[model samples]
Target: MNTADMKSRHTGGSLRTGLPSTAFMLAATAYFLLPLWWLAVAASKSAGDLTTTPSLWFSDVHLAQNLQELWTRDDHIYVRWLLNSLLYAGGGAALGTLLAAMTGYALAKYDFPGRQAAFSVILASVLVPVTALTLPVFLMMSQLDLTDTYLAVLLPSLVSPFGVYLARIYSEASVPDELLEAARLDGAGEFRIFLTVSIRLIMPGLITIFLFQFAGIWNNFFLPLIMLSDQKLYPVTLGLNLWNSQVIHDPVLRTTVITGSAVSILPLVIAFLLLQRHWRSGLAAGSLKG
Candidate 1:
């Protein structure tokens, strides 16, 4: 065959090979997006329209009315839930990321006694299921008399072994030993060096860690379900579940629940949009070395 003919054949074969993978990707996308689309459509519907009208499409836009009901119901309890979720996720992620970075930096940079052992323990801890530790954690909280308080949830949320692992890998990949040595020679304290130099270098990784922890804490249902009894202290997930449970008796709450679920997703979407650039860079850098 002529050169052009040969090239065309190769291109045809490549396209054929990519078809299945492309199909799989499209299927996966639809699988995930369909639920979100349904939620948006459902939330926009009035209670009567929700059951009577088509599910995947919109009818009358009752979103504003539903949202107003959600906000004003029970003296505006949904707003409290939103604030509580923000506090739990935002504060927990930030503090957890900081602790993870410090621990990871020490592991990557310092050659301390039992460093390997400590890292091994952390790795092992990551493999332990969160569900497996729930009872023990509850007991610990009981011992400290912290259950039903914000601390009960916040304390556990602040520890992320996966975050530490990611931080250590990113530290090793991004932060140079020579940079640390140079900073030390210039008389910068260790903590100061970490704050000024190391933090900037590994920021993308920290963002990744923060995002992961934030999502985990935000979606956390069991922790708050077990820890909190007071409705005022409940996170959005627990609060929504409470509303859902009462939906059978109070049919009006059905619309409120759907609307609240739709609203609950907004914070996470906003967070991802805000940090996605840094988070993508972090993933790329971390994957390059580890």
Candidate 2:
């Protein structure tokens, strides 16, 4: 074939190959975004408009009014729920990430007798569903008189087998044995080396772990529902769900619930956007430096 005809045929073949994948990705994106779009539209409407108006289109804008009522109703209890969510998600993620980093580092670097066994246990634990373990965790917390308190939720969140797994993977991939030996030769203690050297190199992985744990804890429903009987101690997920259930008796709460759901996701979105750069730079910092 002539060069022009060959190039035209190649381009046509490429387009044909790309079309299905592109269509699938577009479908997937729309699937995820449609709910969010509906939420935004619903949150902007007044209580009366929620049922009256089209579900995906904005009606008379009562977003500001709805937000005001949401925060002010029941003596501003929604604010309390929001704060509780922030505390639980933020504290749990930070502490969980730290513990995961430390444990993962030890598992990856240390030559302890039971290291492999311990790692195996952690990996196996990851396969066990969280729902399956929830009852046992509740029983344990009840025995300790810690159920209905923040500790019931926070303590369990801190032990993330998945986070530990990610940390260990990153530590092994990023940290070099020679670097540890060099640091030791420089008279740096193990803890100091870990804090200064290993932590910096594995920061991307840690950030990933933190974001995952944060979102998980923020969205956690069943655990908090079982653990916290007091409304004051309830996270946003449980609190919103409580409000949602009450919408049958108090239809006005439907708009409020929708508004609350829209607001609750803001933190997760902001966090991912803020740390996205670090996420993208994973392994590069360690690979270059080590």
Which numbered prediction scores highest in lDDT against the true structure? 1
TM-score, one value per model? 0.98, 0.96
RMSD of each: 0.8, 2.3
lDDT, each prediction:
0.95, 0.93
Model 1, CA-based lDDT: 0.95
lDDT of 1 by residue, 109-195 (tens): 999999999999999999998978888999999999999999999999999999999999988988999999999999999999999
Relative to the true structure, candidate 2 reaches a TM of: 0.96
For model 2, residues 1-290, the per-residue Cα lDDT tens digits are 89999999999999999999999999999999999999999999999998888999988999999999999989999999999999999999999999999999999999989999999999999999998889999999999999999899999999999889888888888889999999999999999999999999889989988988999999999899889999999999999999999999999999999999999999999999999889666535544433
Cα deviation in Å at residue 153, candidate 2? 0.8
| Count of clashing residue pairs in every prediction | 0, 0
